[model samples]
Target: MLLLEGTFPFVAGGVSSWVNQIIRGFPEVRFGAIFLGSRPEDYGDMRYALPDNLVHLEATYLYEPQDNPPVMPVHAAPETMPMVECVHKLFETDMKHPDCAELFAGLMDEAGPDGKVSHEVFLYSPESWEFIKKSYRSRCTDPSFVDYFWTVRHMHTPFWRLREVAVRCPQARIYHAVSTGYAGILGVLLKHRNKRPFILSEHGIYVKERKIDLYQAQWLKDNRSVFERDPSRVSYFRQLWIRFFEHLGYVTYQAADDIVALYEANRQRQLLDGAPMERTSNIPNGIDIQRFAPLRAQRSALPPPVLCLIGRVVPIKDIKTFIRAMRTVTNHLPEAEAWIAGPEDESPEYANECRELAHQLGLGDKVKFLGFQKLTELLPKVGLVVLSSISEALPLVILEGYAAGVPTLSTDVGSCRQLVFGLPGEDEAIGASGQVVRIADPEALGQAALALLTNPQAWQHASEAAVKRVEKYYSQDMMFERYGALYEKNFKWQA
Candidate 1:
């Protein structure tokens, strides 16, 4: 079973593409996926066709309005109060307690239908109300009790929904979560309920990404007045949300049997985020070289002055940075054009903003928004593949570009540095496949692109290095073999 949050069929590119590849790669294994999304309206039609091996696909929206049972007078059981207190303490300490695994297990049980503090009890009980009030008075720095009350309630509303999902989810010998947050928590619950091996493959650290979202989120209210607020410190509510995700990650880490990261640096991050070091390992993303190898022949002898960023035009990808870089790229190479080849419906506002920015910069015909083009068709025509993302986890596009004998220009984020420059020893000796620039630096990005596109020798060198690196290290067969071994090991344990 795959516990997927906002990825797979509903979304495309990045981790979703990798998930699709994994499912298709293992034609023999029967797979079930539980897709969790915020709301039905946020997504459109399925992004990828369902594979034959995918036996089941269940989707649940976390933020949909709930039809709760009518409110009734109730009190928490005496035993439940201790567990409740432990939960509060866990949140307070950011889930650093020695017995956090046991606490998390107990908390899951208490949320169960037969437990003393079930969803009904939590919503309608006087005990829950009193506890909220007590915590507000003791811990909350924000003046509004009303805001505090609603935030706490809203933050926890998903637990019941997840519990319900877990109870009804189809049985699988092993459970795997693509990312943490709600999906990770569900993985924990399913593991506790079924006693199955639970695996976590973190494409990027979910909590860190959530922290970025919370910091920029306009919906989360900051009740403090400008005079009362400290610009240096994060708002209490924002901090509260961050801690909430942190706790979720901690619990998931505690429950996972094997935690996989895309690279060594991310694996280390898993340890720092409370994952058991012994259980964590690295599994870099891989792609089909055979699929893209033929595209090399289709490329021009002289590389085109076209730069393409193949990803969703979302804020995280920093589409604006790519546009700004194009402004500089066009100044030197008058014929140069920037192609953003991904779906824009995911964030229409941001997409429109990027278009407007291009217009403002007078890059009228130089910039193109080629929405969701197939890489096979797109790669052969492009000169350079660019990644201006603020955050990424060993992006598959780079590997895909490499496989197509196209070099990359990416920001020094995630494993971009490792992918571009190569790992130490023989990997390092393969030579730099492309240039890595500072994140959000358009000037550097443009200069790097010009350096390669204008010089055939340099472009050819980078392209050769790219093809060599991907063929040697990142291949679908290599990735499949490793994952197949893991699946077999877990299946044997289950038997």
Candidate 2:
């Protein structure tokens, strides 16, 4: 069974694509899926068809209300404060506590029919009220207790919702979570319930990204009463949210039998965040060279001076920087075109902002917004593929670009630097296949793109290096074999 949060059928991002690839890659093994999303209204139609091997699929929205909270009050657990203290200590006390796993296990035992804690006791009882007030009085720096009251409720309300769905999940030999937030919590919860193997595959560190979002979040209620506050320090509520996720991540890390990351950097970060060293390993993202080899044969000897940025048109992709970079590219080669190809539905306002920037830069006909093009049709046409994302893991686009005989130019985020220059030894010996520039640097990005697009010799060398590097190290067959072995080792199932 796979527990995926905010990805798969409803969303169209890099992680969703990877999930589809993994499911389709292993045809011999039947699979089950559990999808968790923040709210029901955020998603629309399913983006991809269900794979044939998928036997069960359950989707539950965390924020949607199925029914009102029970009106009758129930007796509170006498020992609830210990579990409550264990959770709150993550924020109030030291984060790197040695017995966190034991504290987490104690917290885990406070669920379901047999557990000491109950939803009624947590939501409405006097013990819960005293705990909330005590936490606020001791820790809340802001003036508004009303906001603090709601923040505490909002932070923890998902536990019950997640537990409800987790208990119903179909029995499977092993459970895998793509990331370590809600999905991780479910994986841990399910493992506790069934005594099954739980595997965690982190494409991006969930806590770090959540911190980034929480810092910039406009929706979070801030200093409504107290206006004069230091701007540098994070708000109490924001810190609360971050700490809550941190606790969840640590708990999941402890429960996971094995943890996998796309690169070494993330694997190390997992250790820093309390993942056991013995359980963690790196398995790079891969693609099928044969699938795109035909596209390579179809491409012209010299790729046209066209660039494509294939991803969602969101702030994280930093499309504005790409549009600004285009201003520089068009200043030299007037015919050079850039295709911003991906879903704009994820963030329409951000998409509009990008279009407006393009217009302001006077890239009228020089830039085109091609929403969701067939990769085979589009990869062969562009001279180069670019990613201006402020954040990423191991981007599949770079590997895909390589397989299609096109080089990539990416911002130095995630594994892009390691990928371009290579990881070390045999991988580095494959040589630099592309350019890596600083995040949000338009000038450097523009120059790199122009160098590859305008110079035929340089572009040819990059294209050759790209194909060689992907074939040497990152390919779909390689990924399939590794994952198959992992699944077999855990389940001892012969395919």
The 0-to-1 C-alpha lDDT of every candidate, in the order given, reads 0.91, 0.86
Q: Clash pairs of candidate 2?
A: 287-476
List, residue by residue over 1-495, the lDDT tens digit for candidate 1.
Answer: 999999999999799999999999999999999999999999999999999999999999998887876877777898777788887787676576766766776676778767887887888888888889999999888999999999998898888889889989988899999998999999988888888899999999999999988999998888888899999988889999998898889989988888999999999988998998888888889999999999999999999889999999999999999999988898889999999999999999999999999999999698999998999999999999999999999999999999999999999999999999999999999999999999999999999999999999999999999999999999989999989988898887762
lDDT of 2 at 397: 93
For candidate 2, report its TM-score.
Answer: 0.95
Tens digit of per-residue lDDT, candidate 2, span 292-343: 9889887888768888999999888999999899988988988899999999
Q: How much RMSD separates candidate 1 from the native structure?
A: 1.3
State in Å the error of residue 422, model 1. Answer: 0.3
lDDT of 2 at 190: 82
Candidate number achieving the greatest TM-score relative to the actual structure: 1
